[model samples]
Target: MFINSKGYYIPTKRVDNNYFAKLNDLSEDWYFKRTGILTRARASEEETINYMSIKAVENAIKNLPYDIHEVDLIVFASYTPNDTVGTTAHIIQKEFNINNAKAFYISSACSSAINGMEIINSFFKSKISSKALLICADRNSSYSDDRDTQSGHLWGDAAVALFFSSEPIRPNEASILDINTLGLGNVGHGPQAVTMEPKNGLHMPYGKDVFTHACVYLARLTDTIIKKNGYSISDLTYFIGHQANKRILNNVCHELGLAENKSLSNVEELGNTGCASAPLVFAQNYDIFKEGDLVCLSVFGGGYSCGTCLIKFN
Candidate 1:
């Protein structure tokens, strides 16, 4: 598997600490201390989801043994797409000139990329495809309002691409073991179901309530997956959680009996990249991973979706 991230492109607006002080909110020091984020990347108006996705995929394919056309399938995951009908996968395929590859898109909020991983694993195991490209890109900054400090400060835009192949290679570092997912409440019948609102755009979460549910479900599900995989908590060297909030992550880590540093976080630096957060962490820290090291990735977010996966680098 090959993982890569792109776009540390800066944003235009530069909000200061005093501006936040007037809102009676936490200071910059408090925010950075709590979330470990000093700054986040924001895309410019000229940068669209397609542009970022293409750049990310280009970076991911570099230095690989096979050419881009060798990829038999592409699984693109994102909640924010350039258009509702246009598949970003097709756009990427066209950009890379990988005409032989089949393309599909996944739309599961923040856990979308993890969901893509599961899908790629199934394809490889089932003999449907040998090589699959999983690209996750999101432009969450577009939906955010600078005036709404609460939501605006919690988002960033990014694109990440990962390549997974079934062919067994030498120096196996980490390979995907298994994945498990749980969605809260009924898909179409939940109180927290996504609904379109005229003025509000889209509505579902009520802030604190979502935080409570995320903490409880994420903690329970993560523990269950770790145990079910026949691996003890100590076996995992790293716990990569979705970059949502410091409080939620801290609560989950506390419940899991894991150290704070063991859980790789980028919320402070990248805010929330939606679907790109988890893989972005791997891409940024790929150099730190060694052969046989096991990394557990847990993703939880907006679709009321939660996922857990164990990967061993080669």
Candidate 2:
């Protein structure tokens, strides 16, 4: 089963390039031409991660043919949670009345959902759970500093969910081939602090360095995964990358010798939805997928973490 992304929302107001020009010596054309991003969605102050997750899951459930109660596990992945003390999975479970399933959460920066998929695959293989529902949601806008153009212009809000079942009751068109992860603790040091100051709020990211590392690591790791899986670049139908920046995506495509259209990007429409970005792209384009088509997904973000996975559509 594949998790479908639904109920997409983004902010309407476009922060002009003048904002960046004054703050960071950057321009709108620089962001747009470079990242293929013109705007991103921002959740309202009244909206919380849990609320968005609930709405997204509700939409996904409505689109599904099966009952929600059939799910045996619930896995919610996000770096931004409604609270620090409790797992958001239970809240979703209660909302859906999925009392029989086990609920938990995982955090690996922007790669959380893909990492969650790795774990869900293991659980099903071990017979620990027959089915799992994975949801990736984030509200970066809530943590962003409006005055920091680099980070403000880049961050967006979204929620996406996927359902997985172990039983071969119905043959799936696509199957996960492999998922691999490499932590950049020794290099990027991960997110050491998360603070919202009284005036500026969140700290601004070092855009140049982050973009450099993302392109370099993703290109190398993507090559490694394709080769290790005994597959070539020609085997992939699409390479869905994290919608962090247009330049990074273009650079990775160039490095891999892949065509521009081979990548599915929603950065311009949704900005950086963190872990939700890749799957959201898949969900939006799922209808066009056919059997034997190969899809490669790569993500690199805040944890200074990077991951790549291969999927074959039935």
Candidate 3:
């Protein structure tokens, strides 16, 4: 599969560390030192998951070389869907009048976007669809507890839209080289590490465990995918890890012998935007990617699942 175009939408409301300080008595200096997060994007009442995704598609469609009607598959990868029955994918299909596309939703925590793309790749491989659209968004504020000291300051809201085709459709597009995904539900704290319950809200009782295992799996996935494709760490032009924490990203970079500048990050500004994190980074930095550049996206989500995708600009 090849990437045709990408677009993203981040909420305008910026929540700083002081908000957490006032709400949870966590000092700005302490928070910044621990998480390297100064401010995060928070969505307003109007910026629901559907709204943000629609806006992102609008932005992405502007750069699309083909017509919107060419899309035959629409996948909305989000754990924070506003309505389970009427999902964002269906909404996008309806909004764009893509009456011929198959639409649905999927969730594997933060790794949902990569998994969704993998599904699209499979569909293309099976001759089921030639063109696909992936919309990933997360409204963490909808389920986050502002008073919870553990993760109150770590949530953010954003959305990204990515267009894909089974074959190279345009010049300067990215070609999907390989995709590897793993479900580590039996590893470490697993499901108990991070919880987002309706009654309890989002909490990380085992944040330390999450951080430890995330660093390991993210690095392992990236290393495996790159090596499986016969490339070395130094050959990777850019690395985009799951935007859960700065420390975790640093740990993965260190483990992979990757330099600081080579690793792209958005957690510092967007906090953890759940499934939207990695793709949002790609969309925001799409113009910087040159032809022949090798990019790797590795992600570890709350369900203890991890995945990696290798793409090279063609």
On TM-score, the candidate that comes out on top is: 3
lDDT of 3 by residue, 33-109 (tens): 87888899999999999999999999999999999999999999998899999999999999999978999999999
After best superposition, candidate 2 residue 107: deviation in angstroms? Answer: 0.9
TM-score for each model: 0.87, 0.88, 0.99
Residue lDDT tens for model 1, 85-132: 678899988888897788988877887888898888888889888887
RMSD of each: 3.3, 2.9, 0.8
Residue-level lDDT for 72 in candidate 1 = 92
Model 2: per-residue Cα lDDT at residue 307 = 86
Candidate 3: the clashing residue pairs are: none
Off by more than 4 A, model 3? none
**Local accuracy by lDDT, each model:** 0.73, 0.77, 0.92
- Tell how far residue 275 is off in model 3, in angstroms: 0.5
Q: Better model by lDDT, 1 or 3?
A: 3
Q: Rank order by TM-score, top first?
A: 3, 2, 1
* Candidate 1 residue pairs that clash: 37-268, 37-269, 172-314, 173-312, 173-313, 173-314, 174-312, 174-313, 174-314, 175-312
**Model 2: which ten-residue window has the lowest total lDDT?**
1-10
Look at candidate 2 and tell me the lDDT of residue 115. Answer: 88
Count steric clashes of candidate 3: 0
